[model samples]
Target: MAATVRAAEAGENFPVALRILPARLRSELHATYRYARYVDDLGDELTGDRVAALEAVAAEVRRLYAREPVTDPVVAGMGPLVRRAGVPADCLLRLVEANLRDQDHPRYQSFAELLDYCRLSANPVGEVVLTIFGAATPDRVELSDRICTALQLLEHWQDIGEDYAEGRVYLPKEDLDRFGVTEEDLGAARAGDALRRLVAFETTRAVAWLGAGAPLVSTLHGWARLAVSGYVAGGWAAAGRVRRADHDVLGGQVKPTRSDIAAAWAEGLLRRAG
Candidate 1:
């Protein structure tokens, strides 16, 4: 709980693990936070011993898949949700494997590769949320994939500068080359026209993908729809921010304000009500 609180306070991962959850969900949400934190920590903190840390994460994932109760706080907390939702433990285990994959391979060769990574890194979270809402179905799952993938791409596009600063790149090499961008372009302090165009192109695709999933907001009810709509709206709002910034992602991360989120919330609710 303490670690979860600190992470939220520090504003890592959108304060998602602890803030604004129903009172009934706080405990389990914190547990999920702990699990994600550990996986991330293993990848980032143990960089010097990355291979070993990845092996441990993989082993734990295997154990979880084998139907062993994970004694870790988050894993322990997940047991109830898992049983209640009939969620495949494999999803949780795959999360671990995905984090390890990040340590081994961060750069993507193509848009398809990036989307594949998003499937591993981001899609399962939406699936779990759908299960939590008792709305998991094949159709909703497909919509969830589109929304999650869009969010993942928006995050990547907005963080191009930050990622490059950290000696990593999320921009697909193929797209970068198509836009006449190079590794040297990323090494710049601010984005040049080439990089800007690449971001704009990727942002367009993300917006389109998000739109494809927007109808799911109508397909959901109660707070479940609110949650999904909020996530989808965030992607749209983020894209708007990026566009307003003229795709100057190198300036800094242009995040939507709480007012922006509230507007999205209202828009979603009104649409759902109709």
Candidate 2:
């Protein structure tokens, strides 16, 4: 139902699990992602009275939670899937709140503060996925948190140029100071040594966090295992891109190639098979 909305939000980059999940589960996941993506776009892309648009979206979210007849297409499509999966209402709301936070606070002062933002932005999606898989144990959720947070950090690094152009900066001011990078460095088209060093440092942190979360892969079976491993591999592959580019993100966002994704996917499957 929300397939069109999902495409509008995320151009066919559905999760790796979608390839293996049953049609029903796949549809549910699509709806879920579509809802999140809709909220993000409302906050990030809507021009002129964005706050009003987001407020309207929030009202739609509230309607979904109330099981009322939803007028918004995104909420109507997602409400049933969310209810069926028993995903916590707060989890989805947190995603909306994250985008809301972005409307007000685009630049973070500290890494801790940025992580707090990720709690709202990234962690809820992981929790929702875990719920869908029936693997929302506290231990698993903890592991999922690590993976989701790492993925979010990697995404921030990848979108440095685009984010800066939008007047958003995900890099913490403290880290920038420590690495001797300035806002001007990030704004430039070319990255200098200081900016490269800062990017390297941030990517290393993401790698460490992803590595810590990788063990969650071994704890699952079948498609879930493959899916989690693919996520981990994605983080690593993205980090590899940054490293390969020598962390010069000012030119453009570094992304994993098809070979990188294929190799990482295979490595994930092999790891599970062993």
Candidate 3:
């Protein structure tokens, strides 16, 4: 819970899942935290036998519900909540599985390939939450896809520099070639017009993807609605920030102020009332 809050408050993962969860969901939140932090950490750390580290994470999660097995931080952190909430062990495992894939492969050739990564890296998260809420359904899952995938794309666009440093270029090579963008362009100290145009196009795609899922706002009611709405709105707001910055994402991506979020929330209320 603390780590998830830190990630959210740092404005990295806006619409922090913890804020709107009911009292009963603290455990599930912790389970989510345990899963997300490790999945993300594996990618960031990228150290010392990636396969072994991934296997270790997978083992820890697979053993989570076993009554007699020792509980590590992965289990210890969320053990209580997963027990009470019965968060699917498979969902957590899928996250680790994705990280394993990330360790073995980092470059993505197309938006479709990138989205396939998100199926594990991001989508399982929404699936896990829906399971916790007892709301898993094909229909709702479709909306969740928009939210999750947009978040993933938003993150990739924001982390261009970091990804390049790791020898991983997520921008499809085909797109780069089509735009006449080169490694030199990305390797430059700052983004030039071509790069800016690329980011603008990509950023526009992410914003529209998020908007396509806005109906999820009304799909959930009260806290749940507010939570889903905030996520959708936050994605839109972040897109606007990037757009407002003239799409110089290398300089800095747009981040939402608390007031920006509050304004979004208030507008959501009005829309709901209407």
Candidate 4:
């Protein structure tokens, strides 16, 4: 199956700049997102030594850049985009490194550690988007990093239960200890006071990041502006859902509903217009 079909069938929640971009740009962005999704699935879902599999995937990406034959359909599909749009090879490589880190470290020792992982896992996609859109200045890249990291953190909070089921824990050990939340607390059907407090702390951090990076939206115009604003809005909306749920991530998957995402996008458009 194609990467796009696989991602749709698997129901991955990864977002791209598709909704607001022009048709041509939207196609490029979708192809890029699909490639990333393919790499992530290889690392997370497939059995065996994921480290080796990720390395092989990275090699295919390198081959694509080198104009060599790429066996994987997803990598082959990304070839024209990477070649034409100047998508940085290093940025895509960082994503593979992030997944490799997952194999090496199932739990984070500190918030800083988690942020480092986000730098690898999440920031690259934002950078790739900006690069493809011709808006990747150093300032914009910095802002994009903030938004992407915030989104990654928010996703982590929302999928705490799912991650736990996979034998991975994104909540920093220090925070859990600080809040007196044990691993058992995370596995509970409902979040206890300690887990709630910990989630609240994380939510505050994500909110701060969204606030810090929100300016990126106003820095552009047209489709790029709308796309970035939607990204910022999505982060805000997801974080809002977590807050609205009173940080009870264990009770259910804490994610924004469709209406929440629509509201966020509209609010962002209005803010840009005003």
Would you list the C-alpha lDDT of every candidate in the order shown? 0.73, 0.79, 0.72, 0.83
In model 3, pairs of residues that clash are 27-81
Clash count per candidate: 0, 0, 1, 0
Compared with the true structure, what per-residue lDDT tens digits does model 4 show for residues 83-189? Answer: 78888999989999998888879999899999999999999999988887889999999999999999889889988888998999999999999999898777889
Off by over 4 Å in 2: 1-17, 269-274
Best by TM-score: 4
Clash count, candidate 4? 0
Off by over 4 Å in 4: 2-20, 272-274
> Which pairs clash in model 4?
none
lDDT of 3 at 105: 85
Superior by lDDT: candidate 1 or candidate 2: 2
Best prediction by lDDT? 4
TM-score of 4: 0.93
RMSD of 4: 2.0
* C-alpha lDDT of residue 148 in model 3: 81
Candidate 3 residue spans exceeding 4 A from truth: 1-9, 18-21, 65-70
108-132 in candidate 3: lDDT tens per residue? 7788888788888887777666666
